[model samples]
Target: MVDVEFRVVSDRRDGLLLALGQTVIAAGFTLLRQRMVNSEEGVVLTMVVRGPENGLLLLEERLGTHHLVNSFEASPVDASVANAVSAPAAAAPAPAPAARSNGGAPKPASDDAATAMDTRRVEALLPQLARDYPNIFIQLLALEHDLPPAQREATLRYVGQRVGTWVYKRDFSLGGHLALADAVRHIALPAMRQLVQAELQDDTLRIKNSPFCHRGEHGSSCHFLRGMLGGLLGGPHGTEGLRVVESHCRNTGAEACCFEFHA
Candidate 1:
């Protein structure tokens, strides 16, 4: 068993960085302990993780890929914890089709396909594309010029909702009968696989970790997700009035990215 430890101290608090830390845990590493010690210099975070031989490589890759921190140093630690790294990944439950809560639309064909697109692949390529060609998001943002500030935000949110609807319709071929809560908790997150881990309680859906928009560090991003949630609950045949509001964002310095859905 190999234990690798690394620490990061940012001059300012960054939720994206914290989210990356949580990502290490979500990625199936065994977290031994963590703490934030205050000092005259700044905020210091010391985290210890236990894993197999590739632990350091994985950590470095994750941190470097996301550009979360400027620098980090890792060293081997005594393996005191037993079998922590070998723990199996948690399996997400399948989302069952049900009657639409709002009775909005008709049902569609919902079945498992022999060939399914690998979401992890898509997730990886997207960020790389964004990094390689920053103009992608720039072009998306350029559309905001046509509308006023509030209207621009609202429009983008609506666009995101439509994108969610498209995913449910074309990508998943899901029926309108899926319950919003179940859709988010099961279908959406599971389909996303390692991209994110979340908890949905009532109308609030909290993301513990996500690689999207560089974990929301993209700043003024995830408009599509905001819209996606809206469409997921209220699209087409669904009558449930749903709104998604991200309360905490890694881009803005919160440990987790939270999306609150309310009628």
Candidate 2:
């Protein structure tokens, strides 16, 4: 399924949201899902595609008529989403750096807010999941850190069955130790997003549902959540006019843990 995504760069995202709701409803397009995020850039709209090419065309046409979207750009669904059904979305491309017309730096608060949310976005989504399947969620994190390689693989191979369509991304390349982050991209995330939308999700972080949550017990044997959890854990860019981020945060670096299903 193709997703129509809109990202608003201006401070007045409320205007963007208004324009979006009107356009989608007037056009009779299904509002499959939407998330208003406080991103590193600014307020963002992560919208799931729920209609056809014609629906998108009509929606775009309507948005063009609105002053709110005059400067905002609408891009195709995430390349990765398409690749899931067809071809792999091309390897990630280098996004252009944010620049100032006067060739100076951006204000501190906005930049810091954006940089900080890179890691927090994942956490923001977690509360809802914790509320619903407290057992499953807690069990997963139980095995998050400090596990032997072979054992970690065995855990994921088992958890993947319960969670469904998961992906493994590792960041051990930089450090000498081996690590794994397994995410239930297709299964767990979609369900979670639905719960979030309905305001029905939970906020627990313990994995009481699965026994795997108790791997070394002292050390979280559960990297299933840790597998794809690497991206939000690294250093940031240090160029002039750039924002400073925590040393371990990879949000500004190329060392992303992974992007899987957000259920």
Candidate 3:
């Protein structure tokens, strides 16, 4: 078992809660219970979690995102008395700088130029591209066309899963299972700029009208969206049982991109 206490500086509880969930996922634990105790200075969040191997290390990595947390503490609980606070405190060591894979040798100028362009265009232009340009779609196409077929598909799916984790971590405090489903529905259309029709039955989720399907082609697409759904539902939140499948796609002459998510 693991117990964590976070001292939040601000009452903006939403972000802090989300950050806590992110940290919990990073620590490779399932949050069993959480309590918020109001104090004179600020709110103190106490979390009880199912422990993982190297849980302290995971928590330390995730704490970097807890900007609102003024102070934090964690301790592994003894199995005999899981609630007892007598266990030694886990103090994370200071992180060291990252080293190069090539023994610090300089990379090619052409590689550096490509990397610079990707950073400037992809990172800097993301928000504006989503609003004004079809940059998201363009980038998706570039990913597909710029690499070999297998590598391109694998890259898209991997990116999708990572983005899914990001989305789930940011909005995880929305409450129980039904509420989470509703949260996903509410965020879809506005965020993706496509009409999203969602249906939940048992553990299966069917989603149609994805933004990636707004264009036309000739085969199965929307792999990134599939990855996003997989990551959001399964990643970080202990819902890895969920799986995503794009059964229909506009690229395949379907009316829209239809994704079926099930265990």
Quote model 2's TM-score.
0.27
Provide backbone clash counts, one per model.
7, 35, 0
- Candidate 1: 10-residue stretch with minimal lDDT: 106-115
Q: Judged by lDDT against the true structure, how good is candidate 2? A: 0.36
**lDDT (0-100) at residue 227 of candidate 3?**
64
The alpha-carbon deviation from the true structure for residue 227 of candidate 3, after best TM-score superposition, in angstroms, is 0.2
Roughly what TM-score does model 3 have, to 2 decimal places?
A: 0.40
How far out, in Å, is residue 218 in model 1? 13
Model 2 Cα lDDT, one tens digit per residue, 1-263: 34666554444564455346545655644443445666666666644444566677777776666655434467777646633532212342211123333645322123433343222323222332233232233223322322344445434322322232111111122332221112223222433343122111132212222223323333333334333222222112111231111121122222222232222
Q: Write candidate 1's Cα lDDT for 163-221 as tens digits.
A: 44644554456554666666666555543332346666565666755444443224544
Q: Can you give the TM-score per candidate against the true fold?
A: 0.38, 0.27, 0.40
Best model number under TM-score: 3
- What is the total number of backbone clashes in candidate 2? 35
Ranking by lDDT: 1, 3, 2
lDDT of 3 by residue, 1-263 (tens): 45444333445564455456545654556453355667876877766555555676767656644677766666655544544332222431211111224665222113433333333223222332223222234334444444444444445655555444544445553645533355345443233433245554433345554545443334786767776676656533535466667777777777656666555
